[model samples]
Target: MVSTALQPVTLSEFMQLHNIEESPAWELLNGQVLQKPMPTFYHSLLQKYLVRAIDNANSVYEAFPELRCILSQNSVVPDITIIHHSRIPLGNQPIQGAPDWIIEILSIDQSVTKLISKIQACLAEGTQLGWLIDIQEEVIMVFVPNQPLLLARADMALTVLDEIALQLTPNQVFGWLKR
Candidate 1:
């Protein structure tokens, strides 16, 4: 006898089948359902601090956490997503296109490859900036279109959004984890 895995699902199917409003732990990516692990205290701390930093920054971009972004053929829930004021969605609806900036904080035992792939796809689709933050490593991988990847840590500042003046350093981001 042979064993095979079941096929993945499309975003619409996943949404129709799963009550995303009641259960927000699931995300759809390239016709596949991805279940994110429960966020830890450290993760929440980082998210809260980053959100505040971006929100209070001298810029026109608004920061949102765990917002579902609907792409051409995929749906993603980024840990932190930033969009310019001019491009804000019209009404109470999910974002219909790539976000201007995306930040994903590495969760415990999470696959970094999957996170990178999502970021790359967003960048290819028109996202201006992507960040893969590994709290365990205390480092941030910066991705920008037509530019070399930057590995920032310690005091190195990261340019979050071009339309915003928010620049955060790896140390500042990770410092929130400390009691």
Candidate 2:
């Protein structure tokens, strides 16, 4: 959705005004404020379960939900961000660069095009993996650098983070809905 309240501001300016932990409803794209729809219970559940699942993999990565990642000029709040241990910040500051893996959970009011654009931006900026999870469609769109986008269904296993030897099928992920 178009935001009328947004004034063009750099990432530093945006950060200066908003605190990531407190401003969960906003994101910065290309240095503009964008409002996000409040997440549904299903979205929350999926994010929680996926974070736990990824953490259980015990790789050198750790998952953080609703984390604000600061790119050069843009900032994004991915539903779940898995960052390599080396890149983890020493303090409580927001992530300084693109995450190793980024996952976006679709919401009814969100625009797919905007979401894809965010993913593509991250991929172009050196993100190793990105996933657009559409629980409504029971499908996921995978994005990787210099590779064809992969469309996956529930039963098919999709590579989550190849660098960490992690692969998860949509069914395995969506199955957590039974909780």
Candidate 3:
């Protein structure tokens, strides 16, 4: 993530700037603009597999990639956003609140601290689950409401929304890259 030194802009102004055709996605963190890094091969693959796994798990929730979520004064485009079917925003408008689940795959050279801060921001705004997948380390940092940070590796089963009937592990997630 590259932070811009420009003066802070309101969310509405940021939205206008973000809608330019063919422009790279931008995030508003604490009223500052930050350019998201382009995803690497592994980052892209992990996002695809995770979305597929979550979407296939059940109909109660759906996972979307690169969806912009407007949370209060901050707006973020999480790598993957999972929303309960009933809570899905009704129109062409971007999601107005934090998603039920937010997943971010760490890109090469991206700041892990910033990513974790993003996840924590979402968690503070009602997100039930958050994950930061570290492809190189083959581990996942899990975030849940009111709980300490948890790390999952190898065959450790990952936690998911209670309504979703899928079981996953870091090993299984990384295995997708083998194909």
TM-score of each: 0.90, 0.91, 0.93
Candidate 2: where are CA atoms >4 Å away? 5-7, 18-23
- What lDDT score belongs to each candidate, Candidate 1 first? 0.81, 0.83, 0.87
Best by lDDT: 3
Candidate 1 residue-wise lDDT at 133: 91
Candidate 2 — which pairs collide?
none
Ranking of predictions according to TM-score: 3, 2, 1
**Lowest lDDT block of 10, candidate 1:** 1-10
Superposed on all Cα atoms, the candidates' RMSDs to the truth, in angstroms, are 3.6, 1.8, 1.5
Compose the digit string of candidate 1's lDDT tens values, residues 84-148: 88878888888888889999999877788888888988898899999999988889999999999
lDDT of 3 at 156: 99
Worst ten in a row by lDDT for model 2: 16-25
lDDT: worst 10-residue window of model 3: 15-24
> Comparing candidate 1 with candidate 3, which one achieves the higher lDDT?
3
With a 3 Å backbone cut-off (N, CA, C), the pairs that clash in candidate 1 are none
Candidate 3 wrongly placed segments (more than 4 Å): 18-23
RMSD of 1: 3.6
